[model samples]
Target: MSLEAEIRRLRELDWRELDIKEAGVWPWSLQLICCLLLFLGIFLGMHWYLVSPAKQELQRMREQEVELVREFRSKSLRAANLDTVRGQMEELEARMEALQEMLPTGAEVPSLIDSISEAAIDNQLSIDFIRLRSPSSQEHFIERPFDLQVRGDYHRLASFVADVASLSRIVTLHDFTLEPGSGGVRDLRLSLLARTYSYRHDGGGT
Candidate 1:
């Protein structure tokens, strides 16, 4: 039959008189239409039940892979600088040790004061006083001040100051007042302050 004849026959068919038990006797066009509809339903159902979730999971995995790659790059940069970081740490440790040596802790103050007296005597200066004042505390160190009174010629006083500055221990001189002795003599009565610092430790540290 022609396509127009098949459509005319489908329109003339009496669905009210169709027998459910005799579905095998239905028109071939009607059967083809039902099969196509069923196939489309199954395809949509399969996509919703299976393919959709699989696609979502694949997308999530791709995002996670991107994050992993970024982390790998960051760690690689840090690994490349590991030797340089270690060298900087070693240099800092050496500097800390040297600074600690320069600033001795408690009970070593007297020996340091004695060293100053020896320096003055070696430079031909007379030491009248080497009085240690009360120590002043700071956030990270302690400052111990000493009042030094000496009398000598100009050259010897200068020499003594230079020697004190070059000591193995760290000492800084400040607040100097000079008085000239009487009668054409170059004797200088020098009074000055010397300060030494020590590192402050946490919990009775050295």
Candidate 2:
């Protein structure tokens, strides 16, 4: 037969002659269950593998940030306290310098003599006499005045003289006298006084 004749015979088949079943709920329900299961599995896998770990890591980072903030606050407080202490120390040092300046400077004989007397009293030494004189014309560095003094007791006089030397003003011991004590111990008498000169700056006298 020809190809056209066969196609025409195939198309002429009756539709009512074919057997077809009605749609049932069982197969549709099974397909719906499979789809639900697939969706649920995807949700659980995402929670376990991705979402849960991300949440935990986020929480850990938040905790670390909080700790870092606390540390920063503590360090800032310490820095502030250090600054305050430094300011106080600077103030104290300035006050000390001011006090040092208030003391006698140069060529002031009375103040130097007073300091020596105080040293003698402090060291339990007896001052026989204190004499102060201006430097002779032949002396070097004549700007500073010259002072002389006499005292008694070996150890006490030595300590007294040392204390006088420790004064901020400049003093020198030019001469001394030693004699035997009542107990045969050597007693020393030192004649010393501090000397300071009139200091002159470019502007004026100091």
Candidate 3:
């Protein structure tokens, strides 16, 4: 049929006359429009039910892969620096050993006290008393405190203190009190607390 004739038929034909039983005889324009609408609905339904979920799952996996790659890189970097880290740890251990040597052991306390007495005598200081107190327990070491009282001139007392400090073993002096001695103004009596530390090898406090 001519295009003009078809258009005229469509414009003049329909009023409430079209029905499903007469679908085969429907005008071509109407039938084509219905087919296009049905195809569009099917395409939209398939995209919503099937394609959309699959796309979401694919995106999630890609994100997970990125995180795994980042973790792998971090571990690889650590492995590459392993030797340097070990060297640093060994150096720290050597330093700790050196420090531990300066601290006297439990067996060496008596000798350390004798050394202090000798230092006082060497500097011409009269030793009034040298009393060892009970060792105090610390977190990582034991503190061995002692009380020392002596009578001497100012220069001699200073020399004795310097000698004690210069010993190979570590000794810290505290609570110093100096008063006039019985002899004269030049003679002074000094009282002080001396502390030494030893490493705690065992878990129990000594």
Candidate 4:
């Protein structure tokens, strides 16, 4: 029908009196309205079920790409500085080894005692005794204690201590007791605690 005829039919018809059971017999105008409504519902359903989830996934992938780019930049910088880092590590290890050499092991204890005896003799102090005590535990090393007794004048005692400190192995002195010799002997009695350190490792001793 012509557009004028269709418009006239729509204007003359009463929509409220339309028969629901006989939809096929409805006017062309009402039928066109129903088709348009059906098409709108299908479009909205397709967008929600298919297109919306795809758009969300694409946004998540874009965010992940950005994080990956940052991670790559950080690793590239570290790789560029790898040689310098390795050099520093080697220097630190060499210094640590030198420090370890200054520490004596269990086998070197006797040699250390001999050195102390020589130092006292060089200072003209008579050696009374040199006694080794049990090792003590410390944080990074073990402490070896020694009890030393000597007979000497005041100046000779000080000189002996200085000689002991000059040894290749590291040693520390503590807890000194000095007494004047009895019966006008003009000699002094010197007693002191000496400590040395040994590196701690997998082996229990040394």
What TM-scores do the predictions have? 0.61, 0.38, 0.73, 0.63
Where in model 4 is the C-alpha error above 4 Å?
A: 1-41, 123-129, 136-142, 149-162, 174-192, 200-202
lDDT of 3 by residue, 1-206 (tens): 88888789889986598897887888887788779998999999999999999999999999999999999999999999999999999999999999899999999999999999999999999999999999999889999999999999999999999999999999999999999999998999999999999999885667
In model 4, which range of ten residues has the least summed lDDT? Answer: 197-206
Order of quality (lDDT): 3, 4, 1, 2
Model 3 regions more than 4 Å off: 1-42
Which residue pairs of candidate 1 clash?
none
Higher-lDDT candidate of 1 and 4: 4
lDDT per residue, candidate 4, 1-65, as tens digits? Answer: 88899889889888888887987988788798988999999999999999999999999999999
Give the top-scoring candidate (lDDT): 3
As for TM-score, the candidate ahead, 1 or 3, is 3
For residues 25-122, write the lDDT of model 2, one tens digit per residue.
Answer: 22344346567999999999989999999999999999999999999999999897998989999999998666545445444656677777788888
Q: TM-score-based ranking, best first?
A: 3, 4, 1, 2
| Predicted candidate 1 versus true structure: per-residue lDDT over 1-206, tens digit per residue | 78888898799999899886886878888878878999999999999999999999999999999999999999999999999999999999999989888996778888899899999999888888999898888878888998999989999999999999999889999999989865348888999999998888773333
Stretches off by above 4 angstroms in model 2 are 1-108, 135-142, 181-186, 192-194, 202-206
Badly placed stretches (over 4 Å) of model 1 are: 1-75, 203-206
Tell me which of candidates 1 and 3 scores higher on lDDT: 3
